[model samples]
Target: MTWNPSDFNNTSGLHISPKDMWIPELIIHNAVGDTYELRTSNFMKLAISSNGFINWNTGGNTETSCKVDISRYPFDTQTCHILIGKSSSLDYELMMIPAAAKINTFLYDENENGEWELLDTSVGYHAINEQMTFLKCTLILKRRPLFYILNILLPVILLSLMNVLSFKLSINCGERMSYSVALFLTFIVLLNIVADEMPKVSKTISFLQLYINTQLAIGMFITTISVFLVHSTNSKTNDDVTGAVHAVYKFCKLCSKKQQVRPESPKGDDQHEDKYIKSGQCEKLEMEHVQQTPGSANAETNQSPSIVDAVNVIDDTLFWSFLMLFVLITIVFLLLCLF
Candidate 1:
């Protein structure tokens, strides 16, 4: 509201105090689409300063809803606007000076908000419509990621690493599948928590959600691998052992025999066996027939696949695969956050 307090002054060169006169207080226009819920009453306190200067204070806080963009999440910045103006133009005419020197922003308690840092503010005139002009204060906020790093990200990364390490657990332990499933459930809970914190809009996905989804995929992969390994490692009869397992066992046996033989033996028919042994494939025992045949240990065909060996092979393979995948994921996410 705008008014000249001197209008009530006497023509006899007498002074008039604003304390004895009425000063209009500006109120927010209701027709604006974006609005805030005031935390205090609408009544304002009028102050009559020296020289008949008048000042009105409408001190309050607003709990308004803002459009949230969580694509960067822990490293994101948000801008919120607060509009103020006359509620109606019935009794008074309002005017404003568009000068940056007239505006002042001073927060008494800046440290009250721990998660968000006040970056800066922007003030300007916003035309609500042809009939209304509003003063808008735009507040820019940045999220402080230190707390989230210590509390949320650390635990999630450790959980993923633990899941990778679970591949080392023996199939005979009977806890491999259970451990993987437990980690998978934990990932689900974390993902849900992240989703709940965000607004349900069709914007870009958050970085935290991307990481969580990748971890969930890794967990499911480990669980499936565990189930397959346990099933393959638990076969009681050698008849059920597939050709793949037989091939692996024979290859391993050949490598062991090649390591045992120090001197170079004859290279007649053993030449073919030498190629397979060197290439880590099945090697024919030619001159080495005098030595103990790997198949003779069990009195069956060329070396049967041992359950313990098969389990170990699967565990070793999964451990390396999961580790490499985790490293790749970490690099990709770090680059995303940095850029």
Candidate 2:
């Protein structure tokens, strides 16, 4: 019911109290705390028109339950909802209507602040049952990534690069093992820092967390290899090198990508002609037991470098290979996650 505009000095509307009139009672259904009440303002000023239209602006800070999806982490977007209305009353007695927002043609208002941009703010309706209907406000927010990139992302990337270069340290100088161990510890610390900032949920892990984990694994691998390399480099690897040591020597050669082996048969010796020697390309590790006594002729036959020397020979290749691996994976993961 309404009166003529000429009845009250032709005023379009009047500022009045929301408590003075009967309005829909809206409460937060998915509230997290005891603050489910949406009507926090008592002395609310509303614009009451002569035609009985009421623009009652009502809002307050609401702590509501929202599903957290941190798959993109610092570059992530989040959607949260505010469910408003009490389903205690029958649908005919109470119904929710999305109010027209004052600022724009859209149905809901939007305001963005620091760190998070408000991508969308929309009001919608949902029914609990045949007897009840409620209002739902959806909030879509996207994180501002620049701060996180500088503080966390760039540092982690630099650390990864330094981790690969630890292989270039001299094993005998006692720096490689320590350097690798330090990098491993640093990765662990950085991981902890990141974990603290994120919500504890196993549903969907972020790409940033996965990248850090991969780097951690690499750090651990480098540290273990450094330990073995240092120990072997310091120890005397004579003709009595173990099978495990020889296998490691072969692995080092593989890492260096040199000295590919091919089987070749000797034509002169008929007995040995049918036999193919596969270990010829790599130095003949089959060291003959040379007599150390003076005037022994066979002593000069054991001139080939030991497996330890073989490892040292290809250390540079290993360093470069690991560095390249770090760069390639970093670029791939960043590109995939971003695009």
Candidate 3:
């Protein structure tokens, strides 16, 4: 129906009721919810050109099944697809074609989500089973991690630091058990909270979950060590303590002294102290210096360190070791999850 330009005030297009015309009903094949025909509402209009061509803009919301792999979690990207196919077997009477290979939304994405940003989109026509045709549209999205970092990730990391700090509390110290148990409980609560927001465990396990579980395991280890140290110290004598325990205690004693700055002695005593430091006799020098002090206790000065003393040395040794391990694990997990 070509129109004369001067006949209708130069109007080349007109709007009419969508029900008065035909529309290709594109349905989502992988829909998770009710699959509906992609037809414009009756309240909408179909623009008809003077040459009998029509423009039916059918844009609406859809729910499709999207499988997620959340190993990286808050730092991850997800891809979802919408498989649009004709609702009827009309391959001979009707045909569908993709508008373009790439779908860009710089002009029309006004109500975008705050937590996710669309990264890219592509659409293509595909045929299957020798007869069916469909439009496959892929959408890639990236998560904005700021909300998760503040609400979950940072608090978890901080709680893990508390686990490392608990090693500094002595076994006999009344606060040790309380501190360990409290930290362990905090992790449990946090894990449950995180799990609620995450995909089901049957789907895919995330790195964050594994990281937290490791921390819980370490907490159990520390608690067990504390229980054993408390029990053994209360029951064992220096004679009952094994040679291996004595050696570990002595090694830790030497290690602790190596980190200390040696005090300056008089001019004549310099060579004496030099011999002690060079020959690894610093422990002897320390013993002598304590004995010469004005009010030193004889009970602590002249005997081999008791089992309790050995326990103290072990505590200090474990403190530094576990601290380093915690630091290394935290760094590695952070790098892996973010990258």
Candidate 4:
């Protein structure tokens, strides 16, 4: 019996039987709108009976009906264009969807008369086919090297330099004020840089923020110590000046007292007598003063102003205070570096 074309879809011709002497072919199409046609002759046959019981045979196996081996087709050559859209939420929720895509499939086969059949169709791959598989995609996260340099290293360096200024500046009001101001400015700049890169989350403390705060604390401590040193040195200097003035006054008073106890010489005698009297009076006064003031007394009472001593005391105190401050600041800076 002749096969009725209207009774069977054209796709049924893709399957064949060995007894029927029919062949089957498969074709594939690509996304670039290219068609690849493949043909096979006598690949399938069928056993036709008077009651229309057609038995299909393929690969030396007889079946009740024809079947097509889709595996023989080059599915790899046919690819679909997949446009994926992804969105992420603040809570780390991710969503993805295929917004648009298209697939092309090509069919080629031979009829019972050995005629060729070729067809091409463009349809949504997912609409007609549910068995299509996709390859697993790997996601990678890459960070720029310069991001760490600018966002981390540069800020830390600036902060460290600001901290170093505490040691370089003099421990005076002017120097302290300037250094503190500069340190604060550096902190502000670093904070701004951190704010730009990090999310405004209440629960997190960035590395840059920690570093800036630590440096600011150290700078404040250094400023306070400097102020204390200046005040202490001035107070000590004032005390020394007061003590020196008091000693000088006491020495002058003792000299005045000795002068008041001495007696004068007689004046109405001859020239030689007057001269001898003056000399005797002077000698007596000297002896009496020497007798009253013994060696121990002289040793105890003698006081002389020493310019060198005053200068040395002032210089030594100031120098040592500044030196100690310098060393302390240096040690603190070194510790910060290590940490």
Candidate 5:
């Protein structure tokens, strides 16, 4: 707080209220350390007439670019400083004093601001060599997590789940790759939005940054897996293909065979025998054809590119890998941030 009395005779026993007298102009100087910008405004007011004197009050809300420590991020605390002093007058010519009753008597209530809660306020004197002393007020604030949880964390988590679900799409379709790429781009855009809210300086890695980086890496990995799955469909089923691709074809054939239903035995007599004889003849002809070209049917099925036999294998592998990574990253982030 600051004030000045103009056109007042201190020698006179009569009082001179600011409302009745011309007020003096005073300017404040930057007395805090050189780490923040000076951001404040001043409002002057006249006080009630007193016994033999009058008083004037001058001060206003200040908002500066305070240095932030985001190690805890949504749970962080910050201290900001404000200084009030005469700009042109030295200590010998003019002095600053704090009101005894008002200093350090204020308590901060919770949820007063959306993102930050005022925790404490303090008053002190900062001396500059032997020429000046400035009154400084320091405010302590803590972040409120409700806003960020609703805005940032929840959306990223949903995006991560969407990325995992992308693997369920058919690798034969081009939409699989396109969908995954779109999700990856969405994650990047959300991360950029978050970056805009953070300080430009990188004194320490924030927990939010770590979470975003982990999610982005996961998205990239998912995209890479999708690309590989798409490429796997273009491979031929010849013997020149790798053992892994052959194993994938074998697995697909086994799964298909398990899904096939066996025909039931006939329950009747003479008609059944006739039908059985005809079926036996057909089976004998099929066996002769198989003998002529041993593995032709299996080879033809494996060589078909319309259906990628290896895609299911790739999709299942990627799903489990992504799940484990997601769980591990979440646990670590929780331990580091909430604990």
Candidate 6:
């Protein structure tokens, strides 16, 4: 086999030499159709003008196998042009053609007009465009099991576990509110991260969204319960209040008992304190009044006698009323948590 160097014309001001001439073979593999479209811009030429181009047609090619030779002349640049046809009837709308094509490079050289000989081989792929040459490959529409476990499942499980902490903290103290606020903010951060990842499309709520919303609602409930419990605890009628109520009742009863016996005496000294004075003179004066007026005696006998009895009755009633109120509140809270 012999190599030929055809004569070339140099219209531009440049010397045409033969010593630095070499040909590089460009091979196409996994061609899609009977004819593939190959543009001349893909080739690398050493000594040719940027505009100097060639269009070689690979006519009558097979679907699976095809080859072309370009070793006739020492041209600075070489490019091939061909058209490819589709053979299958399958829908190609969803198919990505550019992702399927892989390319490799092979070097060939000639020594003193001998046949072209292979030197070395290299493997690489043609990029879709210059901007896409260094693209980072990523998977689409397929959920990576490991990523789901880490990003979605793990976070949701951790958030749910945090909710259980609410039960440990006392509802009347700051622990409930503080823990709830912290968990709520955590859910907000996770929600924001999830929102950024997903496309803004209107549809059913995602699993992650449902999880976050549930956690938020639980936190809100915990906060509300904490507030209610604090209010209930603080709203108690303590011993001082009960004592004051009993004292009021006793004083009213004592005043009524004394008014029945004693005349309306405006000149009396400290009537409230004098009414409580246990003196024989007051008792004799009350007896003389009762004997003179049978109606007064009947009224005194019909009326409840002692202030201490009235105080005891009032105290018992208040104690039972507050106990029932506390019990009702506890039952309601229990029902809410159960359901």
lDDT sort, best first: 3, 2, 1, 5, 6, 4
lDDT of 6 by residue, 1-339 (tens): 121233334343232332344222222334555334322223332344324532232223334332222121111012222223222222232222333322222231234323222233223333444332221221111122445457754675566566544555543455656776787788778778777765454543454555556666765665564454444435555422233444555665565565586455456577645664656756777778888998868786656433334434443443344345435543543344233
How do the predictions measure up, each by TM-score?
Answer: 0.68, 0.77, 0.77, 0.31, 0.62, 0.32
Worst 10 residues of 1 by lDDT: 10-19
lDDT over C-alpha atoms for residue 89 of model 6: 20
Candidates' C-alpha lDDT: 0.68, 0.74, 0.79, 0.43, 0.68, 0.44
For candidate 5, the lDDT comes to 0.68
Q: Give the number of colliding residue pairs in candidate 3.
A: 0
Residue 36 displacement in candidate 1 (angstroms):
6.3
* 221-339: candidate 4 lDDT, tens digit per residue: 65565455445435563333335434544554455466585455455647646645564665776668878978865775554434334333333443444455545654554354334
Error of 5 at 196 (Å): 2.9
RMSD of 1: 7.7
Off by over 4 Å in 5: 1-54, 61-63, 92-95, 100-112, 202-205, 237-311
Summarize candidate 2's per-residue lDDT along 78-137 as a digit string, tens digits. 998878887367778876677643213254334535678777677887778777877777
As a whole number from 0 to 100, the lDDT of residue 35 in candidate 1 is: 49
lDDT of 1 at 217: 93
Scored by lDDT, the top model is 3
Question: Local error of candidate 5 at 89, Å?
Answer: 3.7
lDDT of 1: 0.68
User: How far is 45's C-alpha from truth in model 3 (Å)?
Assistant: 1.6
The CA lDDT at 197 in model 3 is 88
1 or 5, which is superior by TM-score? Answer: 1
Please list the Cα RMSD from the true structure of every candidate, rounded to 1 decimal place. 7.7, 6.5, 5.9, 28.9, 12.1, 27.0
Better of 1 and 4 by lDDT: 1
In terms of TM-score, how similar is model 1 to the real structure? 0.68
